[model samples]
Target: MSGSGAIVLNETVHQPTRLRIMSMLVSVDTTDPLAYGFLQNHLELTPGNLTTHLRKLEDAQYVAITKEFHGVKPRTWVQATAAGRHAFAEYLTNLERVLGVRARP
Candidate 1:
């Protein structure tokens, strides 16, 4: 490890894709629902790829996924939990602090 202190992120929101997902989710703050298709397109991920990331977040209790029937098709929507917002914010704070110190040198 470098001399700079290591930034430990909560495992629940640690992976890059999940981190991005969480960030996006927090940005919306449940005011607008994000469908699985929307996330898939926004992240440019295959359905399976997006599902894996979402499952991890949902398992960690950082995100909630709801499924409902839309006509004959099932639709999935995801939102960040309160814990997810807190964790993401904490990560941003630590990241900014680390960058600030590095910039000073």
Candidate 2:
């Protein structure tokens, strides 16, 4: 716990990889889900590595994963949930406070 009223970072969203993933997801339109492969390639993360991070976010109810078949191939899609958006926003606020910065409008 943080003492002296210091701000504490959210462990779940504070991890570097998870933070990057959340940033990308949060920046996109909620209606448009990011493809699994796209995230992996853009982030330069291995499939397993990306999966591991995504699983953690999923467990925290911060992301939604969908698997479906397109043609004969399976595709995976991910999107930030409403709860995730709110959580990320709060995380940013806490981070700004800790860094002595102001929130964005």
Candidate 3:
């Protein structure tokens, strides 16, 4: 094993797609969830790809998904939970620890 410190990463949120998703979700006001279509477009991911990433985060209780129908049209919304934000913060700290340095930019 490498001699790196015992830094633990939230592997679920560490996935690139999921990282981007959580970043966007946390940046927004927690009151409103990002619309499914908007997230797909902004992340430049296909519906299926986004859904797969979302399912992982949802399972981790990091992302909340809401589904409803708008005049018979199905709509989905996603937001980062408080636990998600805390976990993301810890993830960053661990990453910095593993790097043996920290920079915010």
Candidate closest to the true structure, highest lDDT: 2
Lowest lDDT sum, 10 consecutive residues, model 2, at 1-10
Which digits, one per residue and each the tens of the lDDT, describe model 1 over residues 1-105? Answer: 236667665766777888878878998945566898988899888999889988888887878899999999999999988877777888777777657744343
lDDT of 1 at 93: 73
TM-scores for all candidates: the values are 0.81, 0.92, 0.86
Clashes of each: 0, 0, 0
Per-residue CA lDDT of model 2 for 2-105, tens digit only, reads: 67887888899999999999999999998989999999999999999999999999999999999999999999999999989998998998998888897568
lDDT of prediction 2? 0.94
lDDT of each: 0.81, 0.94, 0.89
State which candidate has the highest TM-score.
2
Candidate 3 at 100: error in angstroms? 2.7
TM-score of 3: 0.86
Clashing residue pairs in candidate 1 are none
Looking at model 2, the pairs that clash are none
Which tens-of-lDDT digit does each residue in 20-83 have in candidate 3?
9999998988797899999999999999999999999888999999999999999999999999
Ranking by lDDT: 2, 3, 1
